[model samples]
Each structure stands twice: as structure tokens, then as C-alpha cells.
Target: MQSCELSVIKYILFTFNLVFAISGIGLIVAGALVLSDVGEFDHFMEGRILAPPVVLIVAGCIVFLVASLGCYGAIRESYYMLMAFALCLLIILIIELAVGIAAAVYKNDFQMTMKDLMKSSMQRFENSKGDRTAWNNIQTKLKCCGVEGPTDWPENTRPVTCCHATREGSPPPEAHHCRSAAPQDGILYMDGCFYQLQEKAESASKILIGVGIGIAFVEVIGIILACWLASAIKNKGD
Candidate 1:
């Protein structure tokens, strides 16, 4: 019975390690993609948003290494390797917990930081080609005019991209023509981009925090099983 139990425990640990290894690889790939394209937005965002992807890549590499150690220890029933694997898992769990807590506590501050960044980008929208292009793309995609409203633009002269009739092709009866000399309230987009960007950032942060916590929980389970199996092997040998 003891032998059978040990086999079952080892199998479970092995399967968990394999699954975690695959997950780690997925994270690494995702993070790499983000990091590769991050340069495009660096001018506008100032590389502030790059931290999360970098963190993911680092954590993923660590997770992959720990998973390898766990798998090898389980398969070979190596006591030392199991101990090392458990130690790594504990360290990762603590780090993840700290990250999750920090994210939650600083959630509002992060949003404000992003908001300020976007505001600054908006202030320099016309001066920098990259900023203008970024703002135009954002406005076109989000159907938003400026950081706050159409009035946020200099002299209340909204961009052609903000003209709904120009972009949407179906202007309301009250909508004014974009080429008109006077600024028309009905012509430009009514909504602002700041809140939309903030909401998206917050949602993404929540998902990341949730994933981190879930992974930490799984790591704890893996650590316990690995330590238990190592102890069982030691006692059996004795």
C-alpha cells in the first residue's frame, strides 16, 4: 500500500510540474511578444507599461526552471533536487504574493500615473509626429476626441479624426461639417479617451493579479507534494 501511494504521489507531482512548465512557456512567449512591440509605444507611454511584460518574462523563466527541477526530482526521487525545487517554489510564491498585494494597493496610483502620462502625451500631440500618430490612432479606434473632450484641443479645433461624419460617413442631422470654418459642438466626438484607457488598464491589472495569485496557490500545492514525496522516499530508503 505504501509503495502504491508513493507511486500515485509521484505521478501527481510529475503531472503538475509538466503543466506548470507549459504554462511558464506560454507566459514567456506572451511576454516576449509584448516586449518586442513595446518600442512602438515607448515615445508616448515612456516605457512605463513595459515593466509588467518584463516581470512576466522573468517570472516565467524562473517558473520554468523550478518546474524542470521538480520534474527531475520526482522522476529520479532525488531528495536534494526536491528540496531545491521546494525552496524555489516558496521563493516564487512569496514574490508573487508581494506583487499581487502591491498591485492591489497601488491600483489607483497606477491608473493616475497612466492618466497623467496620457495627458502629457495629449499636451504634446501636435508637436511630436509619433504623439500625433498615436493620438490619432487612439481617437480613431476609441471614437474619442482628446484626453478630456473636444475642448481639450487648442482653440477647440478638434482633429479631422474626431469628426464623426468624416469617419463614420453617417452624420446626424445636427452634426456639422468638418470643413466648416466654425467649431461645431455636434461635429466632434463627445467622449474622452482618458477614462476608457484607465478602465482598460485597470481590467488588465486585475487579470494579471488574479493569475499571479492563482499560480502562487498552485505552487504551494506543488511544494507540499514535492516535500512529502521526498520525505517518503527518504523514509523508505531508511
Candidate 2:
């Protein structure tokens, strides 16, 4: 390749690395926020749900480090460093591709698994303080009452968090007002937490998968540029 061509590739690789480094830092922050927000309930999170954020954090760190390698290699025109950077990109690309495929394939099953987990968690709500707090948080956030529905709660009693009216308005006329003493008219959110939780998880999973695929594509380009530049440098030396 001509000197001008190599210069263009070098700049392009540097630009790509800069963007990826920024993205890696963003991902690390996002993952940390998520882990922090989970708070005391992190212990309750199923392995599948908990794994993603942790993976994001780890991946972010790796990406940040690899990006540095790429940036330095491109700027310094170091053939060995460029080859190492390309190898790292290839490895990251493969791992991300595999994770994306697995997430896509198991998306539906993940929902069902979450539903079952919620039901099980609800069973322990009365006995476990952590579980109770987690359930309350979920109900409040999702505007839902129980795992199955309002009926899942003890008769004539419901959490105050579940009393708020949805955007559609107050409960139907036949439904009991939350403050009322009538057992016949139950005052609780009519919806179940399961569906809301499932939907949220699915949406998040889709976003993650999309981002992973996009990053993988970028990694491929980075790998190619690094390897080509390394080859060009080696040939020029000969």
C-alpha cells in the first residue's frame, strides 16, 4: 500500500479505537449503575439476569485495554503491537458473536424462566426481608401487585405500593378501594408482575444483543485494519 493509503488506514484505525474506548467507558458506567441499583437484592437475582451486567463490565474493561493497544499501535506504526491488537479484536469479536446468538436463541425461554423465578420469589416474600423489599420494588416500579395477580396476596390485605392507580384511571367500580375494609372488594393492582418483568427483560436483552452485534462488526473492521497495516509495515521493511 502507498504511504498515503497507510496514513489513511492509520487515522481510521485510531478514530475507531477512540470511539470504542469511549463506548467501553460508557458501558462500564452503565453496568456499575445497574449493579448499584440492584442494591441488597443482588443476591436474589437469577444467574442469567445478573450475568449480563457483570459481563458488560468485564467486556468494557477488556475493550478499553484493547482499544489502547490499537490506538498506540496505529499511532506508532508498530507491527508487533498491531498484530497483538488484531488478535485481541478477533477474540472479542468471537465471544460477542457467540453471546449474541445465545441471547437471541434463548430469549423466549428466558421470559418463562423469569416468570417462574418471580413466582418462587413471591412465595418467600413473607419470610425473607430481602425478598420482600425486592418484591415491593418490583411492584412499585412495574405498577403490579403480585406474581399472578392481585388475588395472590392475602385476603383483604395488600401493600400500599400496589394501591396507586394506573394511567388508565382508578380500578373498576367493582374493584375494592385499597383503603376500604371490604374483603369482597379487593384493593390492589390488577396486573401481575410477571408480564411486566418479562417485557422489561426482553427489551433489555434485545438492546444488549443489538449492541453486541454492532460492537462485533466494529471489532472485525479494527482487526482487518490492524492486520493490514501490520502487513504493510512488514513488507515495507523487506
Candidate 3:
């Protein structure tokens, strides 16, 4: 009966390690996707926005390495390796929980800080070419004109990016019509970039928090299995 149970535990640990490896890969992909989605806007938030995804990717790599250790331990029935795997998992679980809490705090802090930073950037829009280009990119991508709305800009001075026609890959016949003066009705985007970006950031923040917490739960299970298997292996040897 002890032999039978030891074999069962070994296989189960091996299978769990396989699943854990796959989850690490999944986390890498998720982090990369999130990074690409929000990378362009990093300057606005001073790169605070990139922290969660970067953390996820780093954690994924670490998990992948630890999963390999786990698989080796399970296959060899090495008591020490299994204990080390459990310890690594416990550390990772703590880090993940901390990251989830940080993400939640950041999400709230972002709402307060974002508007001030955007408005500051807007003040530099006309004087700084970088700001102008950034604003144009945000406006074109989000289909928004200014900070709050088109009226945020001086009358008849909105950039060509504000025009829906230009945003759709169709330049106006007269650049002056799009830039110097407002075009016909429905030609320009009426929304603001701030709210659109905020929504996107909030959504990303939620994803980070959710994923971090979810992965931590998985790690707890892995820790339990690893410890249990390690103890069983030791008992069998004795």
C-alpha cells in the first residue's frame, strides 16, 4: 500500500509540475500582450503603468525555472529538491499577493495623478514638439480631440489628428480645413483622450490584480502538493 501511494504521489507531482510549466508560459504571453497594449502610453505615467506586466513576465520566468526543479525532483524522488520547490513557491506566492495589492493601490492613485499630469502635458503641447506628437498620437488612436473635449483647444486650432477622416487614413483635401478650422459636422472626434485612456488603464490594472491573485492561489496548491509529496518520499525511503 505504501509503495502504491508513493507511485501515485510521484506521478501526481510530476503532472502538476507540467501544468505549472504551462501556466508559466501562459503568464509570459499575457504579460507581453498587456505590455504591448499599454506600452505606448508609458511616458504619460512615467512608466508606472509598465510595472505590473513587467513583474508578471519576471515572475513567469522564475516560475518556469522553479517548475523545472519541481519536475526533476518528482521524477528523481529527491526529498531536498521537493522541499526547495515548496520554498520557492511560498516565496512566489508572497510576492504575487504583494504585487496584487500594489496594483490595486496604483489603480486608485492613477485616477488622481493622471489628470494633473495630462493637463501639464497639454500645457506643453504647443511649445514642445514631443508633447504635440504625443497628443496627436493619443488623439488619433483614441479618436479624441483634446483633454476633455475639442473645446479644450483654442477655437479653430485643433490638429488634423482630431478629424475622423484623417484618423481613418484619409487626409483632407485642404490641410487648413482640418487644422486651421473645424470641418463639417461629425468630421472631428468629440470625445476626450483622458477618459478613454483612464478606462484602458483601469481595465489593465484590474487584469494585473486578478492575474496576480489567481496565480498566488495556484502557487498555494503547488506548495501543498510539493510538501506532501516530499514527506511521502522520505517516509518511503525510511
List candidate 3 stretches off by more than 4 Å. Answer: 154-157, 166-185
lDDT of 2 by residue, 74-137 (tens): 9999999999999998887777777667766876776677767776776776688877788778
lDDT of 2: 0.73
- Candidate 3, 1-238: lDDT as tens digits: 9888888888988998898998888788888888888878765765665788988999999999999999999999999999999999999888887877776667667666777777788878778998888888898788887878777777545677877664557664354565655434667778888888888877776777677777777788899999988999889888
Please give the range of 10 consecutive residues that has the lowest summed lDDT in model 3: 175-184
In order, candidate lDDTs are 0.73, 0.73, 0.81
Q: Quick one: best lDDT, which candidate? A: 3
Give candidates' CA RMSD values in order: 3.8, 4.1, 2.7
- Model 1 root-mean-square deviation: 3.8
**Over all chains combined, what TM-score does candidate 3 have?**
0.87
Stretches of candidate 1 off by over 4 Å are 29-48, 166-184
Cα-based lDDT at residue 23, candidate 3 = 85
Per-model TM-score, in order, reads: 0.82, 0.80, 0.87
